[model samples]
Target: MSSLGRHHDPIVAIATAPGRGAVGIVRASGKQLQPLVDALIGAPLKPRQAHYGPFRDATGQPIDHGLALFFPAPNSYTGEAVLELQAHGGPVVLQLLLARCLEAGAGIGLRLAEPGEFTERAFLNDKLDLAQAEAVADLIDASTEAAARSASRSLGGAFSAEVEQLAERIVNLRMLVEATLDFPEEEIDFLEKADARGKLAAIRAAVDAVTARARQGALLREGLRVVLAGQPNVGKSSLLNALAGAELAIVTPIAGTTRDRVSETIQIEGVPLHITDTAGLRDDAEAGDEVERIGMARSWESIHSADAIVFLHDLTRLADADYQAADARIAQRLATADPARLLQVFNKADTGVSAGSDGRLLISARTGAGLEALRQALLKRAGWQAAPEGVFIARSRHVQALKQTAEHLAGAAAHASQADQALDLFAEELRLAHLALQSITGRFSADDLLGEIFSRFCIGK
Candidate 1:
């Protein structure tokens, strides 16, 4: 699509992870793979058959012994003739074997693969679409089991198929609407038609449903950013260490143990949560004051920006006399008339914040207590309770496209209600919406997007 560079000759690369192990695989795919195999292994290897063979040098001496499998074109990963060398995993051995391939293939025309070029070839050859191609990278980069599972589903075309199905639904309705516009007398009073309205309602519901799922998928892909914020000595650092299950943050009884944001990526029930522990917020003029001021300013910013804010307070240290001052400071910072993004987190339950702190989590971070409840609360705020069945991996780009398509669909619905002649524009918007949907699945995308998507893939994938 973008006139991306591709080798007309066969391409070869080490497919397995680069390292010394029991076995390593060198994969080759393209037209002219047979000759490379013929020279490298010194025989006419059978297609789809794993032949135990001896690899040799140009002088026809044995280099190493391994199995070679050939997958003929129109059947392999790139719809090309493929050869795989299952050889020793020593880095030096693989390099020698690769060098032999380069030498042998030079006579038969072969080249080394660029980063992500193999997967790019697969996509170009119709083996996978853009989204599935992206899922290839996602699967490789999946940090957690849940992320891996979601990426597996994506690579299996779950996410793309859903988007395609939604587009088909919208297109079907648009066709009906366009038909009504084309021949007003042919269809039974389309606007007043009960079935038409019902169909419209169904499409709307479907769109809303998919949009919600996409949002959740987006959260799963881009984990929730939860910021810990409160006054100095509020046990924010302790809370970070507790959540991270490690000393990710420097915890000290000192008021400003954390002078800057300490971030950690954690997994809770397969949901990735990014926790940012910020410096304490308060008023003071010393260096501690400057640090607290910076921390306080950052706390307010994060509170406004983060998906959820955990407002920490040292229950044992928060004196009744200081509650008014503290709450006033926090309230003033949070005074903006916006949606609620803050959650009260009273720390230092080990110090006994009084039995009256019953409604809130009561635990000692020092003792590694109350963390389960905290994780659950975070997950609840993240809307991550849904099972992975309906969940699929989605990129921010996919979310943005879906949102744009939703906006257009809403506009189309509005037009449908107001003007008889508006069906034409509605049809146009519906087309746009459909294309936007296809963009997610890569049915509709430019070459640049494909290049960008594949560029992230590791070589040999």
Candidate 2:
């Protein structure tokens, strides 16, 4: 839809879940909802007050007895005249109420709301900024308590406030730098006298602080994807069951017992870890049948895409030359792909097996020995320190924006530090940095970006 088209139409939707519940709500938003109120409820509604009544169809037949609420324009969620019919929480009942609303408001252009159209309207009407609009969806999808609280903080404008503050500093610095360019001959060094370099340094520091918090928030929103990969029968399934505290993956002594991926999500310190147990890697030609080959291929695929790969080494077989050769081959492939995300773990420590290298962690999945340390190691690899008291939830897009802003600031700093600095280049860098920061809060955003964001939200939100 065009920018103005969103505001021109009246929208209706079932605001509650589809299944049976205590109550269900059918909501309508438009320029004027008094007519709709009169049609559906057969009486006038007091603003912001719920009146117990019967919601009737076009024939004046009672569809459901419920509460009617009316919110006049500029005071409702969408900043428009809104009407809500709270009726019995049954699928058929809600459907009837929704249909009645469409029938009542048909002349006024009332149509079914698109996914996230309600929150999108809130954004367009200045009721909430882009960041806050996004937080509304994040708050709904939050999987952990920490994540929910963090999303709440973002919705409350904590994250946007920080971005605005950074933008203000950049604006001030740009103004100082631009002034120097406008009148080069004019006078006592404007930048030097005003301590422009000192201000730039301070802005850079602030960006770093916000970037750190944003990283933590992103971790909470998009938890680590950890893949357990190693040779066959190396206790990969056992380790998965131990971490999940459930027998999610089948365990057996037979080789190639797990021919597919077994996945589970578990939280440590309020940060989720999506763990996957995959078919073991092997070099032998006679390792498995056709199914096992496909499974191993999938295991490699998971490893390449994972945030972290736990290389489980059977400590008991460390002394065997064949096992050593196979491990060396796998290590070579990992080093070529992503060596930084790999964590060497020696399994079966309860059998008196020890790690050959100091960098590797020794753990016994059977007895749960060293499991806590393993959890901590996984968190460390994922770049999650801990869930701080006031951390906010952030998406990957937010993290990318912060990184881009930081890069621009770094460029600006470099230009500022030159002995024979170009003021124009420095000012341009600051402008770019400001724009990047603005993108986070949607001061400068594209229409397509907004569509992609709100498309993920549930309908009527």
Candidate 3:
């Protein structure tokens, strides 16, 4: 069906999650829901008020006793009339209720809602902007309390507000620049009088600030991928166990005990870290078997892809010549890695092994010593700045948009600073920057991008 036609039709879905619960919601939204309401309840329901009643089938058979709610057009979630049935959360019950809704509204072309269709409609109807619409999904999928709070902030229009404010500033600057573009003789004098350079500088600074916050928010939403990498038996598994507070990885004294990656997600101060303890690093020829060799290869793969690498070291074994040689080899391979993301952590500090001044963290996975410091370090590596104020959740795309805006603003600044003062170029840059900021709140977004984004949402959102 055409997008227009599909969206115009009445849509129904079991609004609650699948499985039994104390209550479940079956919802319908459309331009006109009076016919469906009459077919289901036989009487008009007070808007926004829940009415306790028995939901009957076409044959007048009571399918379930529940609460019914009606929200008339322009005052509902999708800016359309909405109907909600609060019913028992049993799978069969919801399915039957859903079927009944379709049956009753068949005349109105009511159909099952597609994934994220409800929220998408809300976006289309101006009830929510693009960023706020995305927050609906992010809130549902948040892995940590901080992430949830951030998503809630975004849903409450915090992120969109920032973007809109930034866009408004850019628009005002664009208008000023474009206004001066037609008058070549007066352009320089007009811009100088208006302090265009100063305004552009301030806008650039604002973009930078918002971009930094958006980066931190993206970290909370997406989390970090951290890989524990070093020679075999470097206490990687033990450290993983300590960080996770669970024995998620098998820890054995024997070398090559772990032949694959064992991962666990643990939060430190509301930021999730997806920590993966990989099979110990070793020379391909030194691997004990084909499985171990494949495991080592996979470890390298994880190491290369990880956002951060915990170069775990066994303080007890650092003095051993064989271990040193192996550690040196691993370090050589890791030399190409970004130094900022690579952390050298010496383990087994409880063994009384003195860690010399290398400025590396010293910890004992066995005793949980210095684990807190390690967590802070990981957060630092991820560039997480825990603001005292609430942060709105953002995606990588939002970060990219902010960066694009900054780049265009930089171009505008360059044009403005030139001795010749290219007013047209300056205006064009401002226009582009404005559009970039608009894309964040979906004021200017491609149809395909919208589809890809909403497709990730759970059905009925």
Top TM-score prediction, candidate number:
3
Q: Which lDDT tens digits does candidate 2 get at residues 82-132?
A: 888888899999998888888888888889998888888888888888889
Candidate 1 vs. true structure, TM-score: 0.88
lDDT of 3 by residue, 1-461 (tens): 13434889889989899898989999999997877788778777998998998888898888899999999888988888889999988999989989988998888899898888888899999999999999999999999999999999999999898888888898888887777776667636856788899999999999999999999899989999999999888899999999999989998999999999999999988888999999999888888999999999999999999999999999998789999998998999999999888999999899987788878799999999999999999999999886546688999999999999999999998888873358888888899998998898888998888888988888777
lDDT of 1 by residue, 102-196 (tens): 99888767888777877787777889988888888887877778888888888898888888888888888888878888887774566567355
Off by over 4 Å in 1: 1-3, 7-9, 107-109, 184-188, 259-261, 282-284, 288-305, 320-339, 355-363
Estimate the TM-score of every prediction. 0.88, 0.96, 0.97
Residue pair clashes in candidate 2: none
Worst 10 residues of 3 by lDDT: 1-10
Instruction: Note the Cα lDDT for every prediction shown.
Output: 0.78, 0.87, 0.89
Candidate achieving the largest lDDT: 3
CA lDDT for candidate 2: 0.87
For model 1, what is the C-alpha lDDT against the true structure? 0.78
